[model samples]
Target: MSGTFVGMPAFPEAARGAVHNATLRANLRHATTTIRRKRAVAVAELSDWAELREAGKQIKDHTLRHLDRYLEQLEDAVTAAGGTVHWAADADEANRIVTGLVKATGETEVVKVKSMATQEIGLNEALEAAGIRAYETDLAELIVQLGDDRPSHILVPAIHRNRGEIRDIFRAEMTRWGRPAPDDLTDTPAELAEAARLHLREKFLRTKVGISGANFMVAETGTLVVVESEGNGRMCLTLPETLISVVGIEKTVPTWRDLEVFLQTLPRSSTAERMNPYTSMWTGTTDGDGPRAFHLVLLDNGRTDTLADAVGRQALRCIRCSACLNVCPVYERAGGHAYGSVYPGPIGAILSPQLRGTDSDIDASLPYASTLCGACYEVCPVAIDIPEVLVHLRERVAQGGQVTRAGTKVVLKPARGHAAERAAMRATRWALTHPGAVRAGQRLAARTRRFHPSRLPGPGKAWTATRDLPAVPPESFGDWWKRTNGGTRDERGGSR
Candidate 1:
């Protein structure tokens, strides 16, 4: 529930506990089912939905290909607009930069807009360690913060909690963070919203430093955009005296024209809305308008390494829409916590391993998390081939380790476990490639079919425990075909 993902087990192990919890399963089933149904209706409204989806994908791909040029352009534009840009190579560097910025402001508390980039770097935990209090203003995020829980979904962090649970959390935990919930508060939507609003209002007015993550950063205008259904993002962006936005480098697009494609796709894909209720945009700072000081920390955080992979680089195209999560059978039952990262579901399966590497149990296990149903790929706004990437990462996991390309040099890091799986795959590859060996092996197996065991031995025993091992035929297909002369005759070469 804490910001840190340390010590979490692999997906299968973590999911085991979640799958058994009846309350958790009920919560996930209801939430994901509702969201996916509504998203379908919203998407159906657009006649050119397919075109828009393709446009968004093309825009993201183009930007990623020329990310350096656009990023440099963005820096020049932001600096020209009275904003300072800082580049962070990883999470530690990003946290240090953000912490230093807050410390320099001489403030101990900061209000936060729901920013995945900040969460990814564990900025809240990092700031807490530095004695700085970071408050989450988004209602769902507020629920997560007050409940001391990690986000299960990208858009709706509190999706795992029902209304009754939320009411209880508000009553029990609200006072510790700020204003107490009304003693007679009911388990109604309005009351819960009001309670969160009142509690967060105090922090919004008092806090001078605000931290955020943008949905999109326009390279041409040096503008950062945050789109949300609630008005909390607007409050965090404007009310605070100094605003520090920690954004991923891949969030950049070449121009506002390019931004337009996502503007249409992101809202519908994420919140199922035609347009977000509040679309906040800021070009650095306006002396009389918004924050006095604006700092942009562009975070790499293994993104550059992920970019080194041709298939894996598509993850950077993510706009943080939870569309894939809603449609994913694996995520619905297992929940986001099973993935053990800020990003969860289908995207997490491929993205986490690449960003964090497959050395850990969780990362290695993430690739095998899905059924490879391709529901995720179908819903993705950017059309990222999530299933394709999942297969690619699985290959990496089973083939020893990651193959990272740094310019002309390729670096390989040995990963733990998967030895048996690797051996099996290698043997399979060899057997499949050698026609004579395959034919001979099939003939030998067919000859000894009567003596074959009903179950496999060793590690494969568990696989065949619940399911029957297929019965081998008395004769191999080749021999049958040859004997029948391609099935034209029974025992003679002549046609019957």
Candidate 2:
């Protein structure tokens, strides 16, 4: 729900442009294909992957079921460990709390680890508006920041950009932020990484405040974990004098023992590695070790509303592995930008609508963005039934049902442009209930089959534009059955 994505075009309209970009398609295809193959191999090496996935799902379900208790326990543990806890009920509150925390430190600039929660709240924009400059230290995040672009992927935010484009961004925009790129920076991976490293190092050493979002928070110990392939997370978590983390309340697990399940599944599912190269875990603050001041902002931002739905609550179990993105046929082609949220791909389709309510054009269109392939569910570490949620959300959008917005229950008007669909569904239900009417309708359709237009007019044109209307046969199936048999068959034996 960041302002960055506000007023975005609906998915179909946005995807129409993305689908035409050959270079973007090439970049996404190569990245997703490579990751997909490697993930398969990495997952196959584990003998009890199904067990691990189920265990992960059960743990999240149990923790979410008792979320209030775990959150209180986590807050107490954090306070006891010398860290302060702040509860944020929505995006505006979270941003205000983080901005206020940074202002309290008297620092004008803060270094950031890659954080989806921060992105969700649009923290950088909020900080910038308050005269605080926030620098993104993650390699991919750096690319996005330098280009003044929004992230298109979750794990690898700059997945849409190739090497050459990255080099261009650094060369053109790096100096305005901090360190400038090398004059002769090449398009090689090593060179690009080195350019980002040198550029971020100065900011890392000088910045007095650091901000992050955690992969998981241990309620029993008040420890937060961030897993990454690069060591930038370590630097951000340790180097700054003041550290503030904005985490969704749903990211908390009951104990360190429950954290074990995700530590195994996340690395393999995300980067296709047995273990990530860097995993940083910190509890409160340590003397003469890391940041002397620690603040944790717990963000609720519609998560409580999402948890209120039994069928939709499973989305809270996601570990941000992004396995579902790689396997999603829709994501592969439409790309992440089309989803119009910090979260993209299959997860975004279901998650965004719930978090933001399907009242907006972009949020309303997201549930219809997928093809319902179920590939996302097959690869999900916590087995979130994404297709099931998509359909459920579709019903919510079509029928206009009771939903929670900002913690209050409200009924939404059915989304615009669905009147015909709603009427058709009602007609279908009626015909199915009345066999005689269905028989009559079928015979009428068969008789007037040739008179049917090849293309429809008005509202129906949109549906028929890309699809062919199936031609009706000369006779209905029921009529053919009766003619062949000459009479109804007796239930106990043969035709009479």
The best candidate in terms of TM-score? 2
User: Model 2: number of clashes?
Assistant: 0
lDDT of 2 by residue, 236-327 (tens): 99999999999999999999898778999999999999999999999999999999999999999989999988788999998889999999
Candidate 2 TM-score over all chains jointly: 0.96
Best by lDDT: 2
- Candidate 1 segments whose C-alpha is farther than 4 A from its true place: 1-3, 405-410, 413-416, 429-451, 491-495
Residue-pair clashes per candidate:
0, 0
What TM-score against the true fold does each predicted structure earn? 0.94, 0.96
Q: At residue 162, give the lDDT of candidate 2.
A: 94
CA error at residue 421 for candidate 1, angstroms: 2.8
